[model samples]
Target: MMIKELEKLFVRDLEKLRGELDQYPNEETLWKVVDGISNSGGNLVMHLCGNLQHFIGAVLHDTGYVRQRDFEFNGRMDLNQLNEEIGKTIEVIRSYFKDADSETFDGDYPLEVFGYPMSIGYFLIHLQGHLNYHLGQINYHRRILS
Candidate 1:
C-alpha cells in the first residue's frame, strides 16, 4: 500500500512534468529561466530523473545508473527526449515498487543521503517531497514563462 501510494505520487508528478513540457511552444522554451530564477523546466526534469534513477535504481535496486549531477542543471535536452526520459523514470520507479515489500522499505538505505541515517521508506518520502518541491517550481516556471 505504501509503495502504491508512493508510486502513484511519482506517476502523477511525471505526468505533470510531461504536461509542462507540452505547454512549451518550442523545445527552447523549456530552457528559459525567468528573471532571478536559476533552473529551467528542462534542468528540473533532468535533475528529478537523475535523482530518482540514482537513488532508487542504482542505490536501492543495484541498477547501476550513473547520475551526472552537474549535467542535470547544465544539459540541453530536447523536449521529446525529456519526455522519453520521464517515461523511463516512471517505469524504473514503478518496477522497483512492484516487487518491494514493507521489510525492504523499512530496511536501512544504501547510502546516508543528507549525512544522516534513514530508512528506505523515510528516504523515499523525502525523495517524493523533493520531487513535489521541484514539481511546484516547474509548474510555476511554466506559468510565468508562458
Candidate 2:
C-alpha cells in the first residue's frame, strides 16, 4: 500500500541522514553555524527531530504533544544523544505510519494542524522533503567545517 511505501521511504531517508551525519568527525563541529540565517549542522538534526515530534503529535494524535520550539534552538548536544533523539523520532514516525490506512493517506483523514488543513499523505511527503533539505545542509556543513 501507499502507506507502506511511504514508511519505507521515510526510514530510508532517516538512514541516509544518519549516515551523512556520521561522517562528521567532531560532533561539536556539527553545531557551528555559518551564517545568521542558517542553523548549525547539529541544529538541523534537532530541528528535524523536533519537527517529527510536532507532526506525530499534531497530525497523528490531534493533541497531547508539547513541542519545545525554543529548546531545540538552544545549546549543543553530544553526538550520541543527538543520534538517540533522531532514532526516537524515527521510531515514533514509523509507529504512527504503521497504523495508517489508505484512507488516511488519501485525504479521507483530515486534520487541522497549526490552523492549516493537511492530508496525511501530504504531511508525510513534506516531512520527507524537509528531512532531505536539512540533510543537504548537514552535508554542506560537514564539508565546510572540515
TM-score of each: 0.96, 0.85
Pull out the clashing pairs in model 1. Answer: none
Give candidate 1 regions above 4 Å deviation. Answer: none
Q: Go through the candidates in order and give the clash count of each.
A: 0, 0
Alpha-carbon deviation at 46 in model 1, angstroms: 0.5
Q: Report the lDDT tens digits of candidate 1 across residue range 2-21.
A: 77888899889888888878
Q: Per-residue lDDT of 31-95 in model 2, one digit per residue for the tens?
A: 88776446888778878888877876555755455777777778668888888877877788777
Which stretches in model 2 have alpha-carbon errors above 4 Å?
61-65, 108-115
Candidate with top TM-score is 1
> In candidate 2, how many Å is residue 74 off?
2.4
Assess candidate 1 and give its TM-score to the true structure.
0.96
